[model samples]
Target: MNIIQIDRHSGQTSSQILAKAMDLHASGDLHEAEKEYLAVIARGYRVTEILPLLAGIATINGDLQVALDRWTTFLDLKPSHLFGLMEKGALLHRLGRWQEAVVSLQAAERIDPNNPDLLLNLGIALIDAGRGHEAVTVLKRVADIRPGNPLVAHQIRRISSAIVPFWHIPMLNDQPRNDAFEEGIKQAIAAHGSTARVLDIGAGSGLLSMMAARAGAQNIVCCESVGIIAEVAKKIISANGYADQIKLVPKNSKDLMVGENLDKRADILVSEILSSDLLSESVLSTFEDAIDRLVHEEATIVPRAITALGCLIESDVLAKYAFVDEVSGFDVAAFTELAPTRLPVHGKLTSWRRLSDTHDLVHIDLRARKHEASYRQVDLPVTADGIAMGIMQWIRVDVAEGVEFSNPPDHYSDGGWLQVVHTFSRPISVKAGDQFALIAGHDRTSLILMPAG
Candidate 1:
């Protein structure tokens, strides 16, 4: 009876300590709350729940190390505890331990597969770990589940952007990205002459607007969304003696107002907003919004349309860029799991083969009277004999009157953007007269190509 009394007394004391901790925590006295929580934990009371609260307080107070320790303790006591697992994973991510975070979050996901938050966190963790392609797979799921979530959408854009190979930037400069604009500008000028009111979205280096001005445009409003780049563009416009003819708006394509930024609706719309893979920069939405809200209905859009070109190609050269196979007589296959990336790829530098000769992917008609979402299954006929590596993509621009340009596969050569070759897992061998079906669409920020029937 005496031993029972002692046990009851101990339980009462533990309960009292937990109550005090809860009260303090509820009152926002986290430091005092922490003390009480520790006291309850020391007394062996509700370790799972109390430890998470302690970890939460620590996390909120910016004591990350303490939070990590507390979360670890909670997980040890309750390994499959969903909240505890997520807290620990998030903490690991905060500490830049991306791989560890992915494992933890993935475990948590296995425990609770329907949790969108867990999936989003896992995607973020994967991205931080440098597994961009993998991250895209996870993030795309999140996007489908939470269509209006900007953050999830942003992550999708980020991952889609990274799928491009890196070596193409220098090569892009050598291509005709700028020259295409120049030709388009001259055409727009000849069509409208000096009387044309021009709007240039994404005015990189202010080159397109200056080209417009040189082609004799008056009342040219050039909007560059990047501040630093806009500043440089402003200087370039001044240097090129077209500053008086051009007005620069240092804001995003969406931030510009029709009346506030321009006296009248633009007669000609000029923009160099095409990224390597076409939609990586949300050119579809930007053009749609600009056209619907900012520009006139009949406004001539430079690069009136852009065709997103893609093809199945094979490359032994691209192996190193996309995968880590053999390294110094060691097979570090596990390390490939930690690979990081978040940008488009250029196929020019990588050793690859055109399994099925280049094919056109989806094309966004920027000059359409109305913009709408659409998708179609495309059957690409293989006209060449080669191993199909993956989709090689580029943009073919219909700049202006009689000015047609293409970032041909032979050249990842262009300015500001390069043609991206998205490699597949394994090469698909094909010969002349072979055909493969693929589903292709533009989701505002990404051009998706998936295998179809």
Candidate 2:
């Protein structure tokens, strides 16, 4: 055979070019080493081995883009290179290209599914990509492989707590609320028979669905929007032996399909979507959608109506949380404009003086098929000579014909639903006979509370 010259112009063989490149790279002469490596690649000599060497050299010089290019070239020749995919993903994460990082890491994870380092990077990339719920799956794999790993456990907890609302845990412990809802479901099941299809819009922990199953209902479907919570519900439901009777759908009530998700429109509907101010969680839109699509013409809605009960109150402790005038001797009253109009206050822990008798501020008939953004002027009659802060509101649910539940400020404490302080723009001094002409209504999702001209 004729002697092979990889670089005819330099009269050097392929082995000689690679040997010089390796020596220069080892001696920390990256500039000269890269030139030799490029010559080797140009001469079509050992490109597969030289590309990774070039990439490592570029990395050493902090040339991330060039390193990434070398890695891409190397991967193009060998797409199944797991470490190449991982290195590319890590660089993308550092560059803040989160979604792309997730894509790359996921590819590596498919090859070496048991590598903790690989799975951890994938989970982190998924979280940075704003897909934390999806990250839970990856982290769970790591969790299983590396049992008792506090870091993996902590990551799972962080995502779980972030996605699940704080109110859900407390709401589950609210005996009065739970009892009322359970009683209503029992009544509905009794009326429509045990086999009637019961639908729970916000099936947190699968509580209501299991309650329906326990109350002799044969069929129940519950929907939860939070994916993590939905996973928890599946475990809880399965553990409680209601897996056959209850079908949990991981979706918002608005997204639930009538024909597919549910065999037909439900015969009974129940949901606990009310926030502190009553409408902040889009209860109106949720209920309206449930009526128009999810339920039958005369579906036995568990909470047939929701009433927002409130009273004018004055409290020094409560005012600071809302309207801040002088702070550290600075008149930053303008900051009060950005203050939250309502606060979820613990009824038992907070102190306040009622300046007016309790009144029914807004009444919602949940059975209605539709609702409009309603606002009207109202006169809130005062009973004492004190500053009018705003309204201390709570929810009163008409669960059934003879069953009802409420968390009034005075009578309710440490319940799932806390009393809300609906504050005004500023403190208004008023006499005992004074009346506040204020506008109150639902803006479809949030409550409107403001002074009327």
Best by lDDT: 2
> Top TM-score: which candidate number?
2
TM-score of 1: 0.58
lDDT for each of the candidates?
A: 0.76, 0.88
What digit string (tens of lDDT, one per residue) describes model 2 on residues 3-102? 8667443777878988988999899899999998998899888888999889888888888888888988999998989989999898888779999888
lDDT of 1 by residue, 295-345 (tens): 777778888888888777666665555556668999976665554322255
Q: Would you estimate the TM-scores of all the predictions?
A: 0.58, 0.91
The parts of candidate 1 lying over 4 Å away from their true place are 1-175, 320-343, 383-387, 411-416, 425-432
lDDT of 1: 0.76
